[model samples]
Target: MIRGVRGAITIQENSEKEIIQATDRLLHKMIDENQIMPEYVASVFISVTDDITDAFPAKVLRSLEGWSYVPVMCMKEISVSNALEKCIRVMMHVNTAKSQQEINHVYLEDAVVLRPDLASK
Candidate 1:
């Protein structure tokens, strides 16, 4: 079966370092929480708010030891009024046995406001 894992996190700044750190944190959490193995990941699609132009989140993923073979892409998010800033969102397609309801969606930092229903306790 195939499942999608969603996650979002807010970065403190637009610097490449900050983007990389935030993306790393969010991806790690999502992988850990979902018990996902790198080989099981089909692909990853990531988007960042327009304000974040310093880095591509997908580039950071390449630095991961076992993620080099995983297909990944990053794009700019549609800018909307009242939307969260410095936010990065990711959707990962994985081959997993779990059902949709069994997947965990992660929302961290100020991005938590974007999905109160899925916010971790």
Candidate 2:
């Protein structure tokens, strides 16, 4: 069966380094916690807030961790009223033997506030 993992995080600033670092950390955490391999990943979709044009989070993942083969795409996050700023959200689709609930979705840094219930655990 195939399962998908969804992780989201908000950047503390618009700095390129911080954006890259936070995304790198979140993606790695989600993959590691779920035991997901690059080969099994069908695609990874990343969306960043409009203020986050400093860098594409997906590109950071591709270069930082040598995930050149894994399909990665970047998009603009929906602009909603009072929405979190400088946020990056990822949806990773991978072929897995596990169920959706079994997948570990990561929320790091300030993004954890988005899902404090799960983050607490």
How accurate locally, in lDDT, is each candidate?
A: 0.92, 0.84
Residue-by-residue lDDT tens digits, candidate 1, 4-110: 89999998879999999999999999999999989999999999999999888898788888999999999889989988999999999999999888899999999
Q: RMSD in Å for candidate 2, one decimal?
A: 1.5
State residue 118's C-alpha deviation in candidate 1, in Å.
1.2
**50-83 in candidate 2: lDDT tens per residue?**
8997887887778845578999999998899988
Model 1, position 3: C-alpha lDDT score: 91
The number of residue pairs in model 2 that clash at the backbone is 0
- Which runs of model 2 end up more than 4 angstroms from their true locations? 64-66
Candidate 1 residue 81 Cα shift, in angstroms, is 1.5
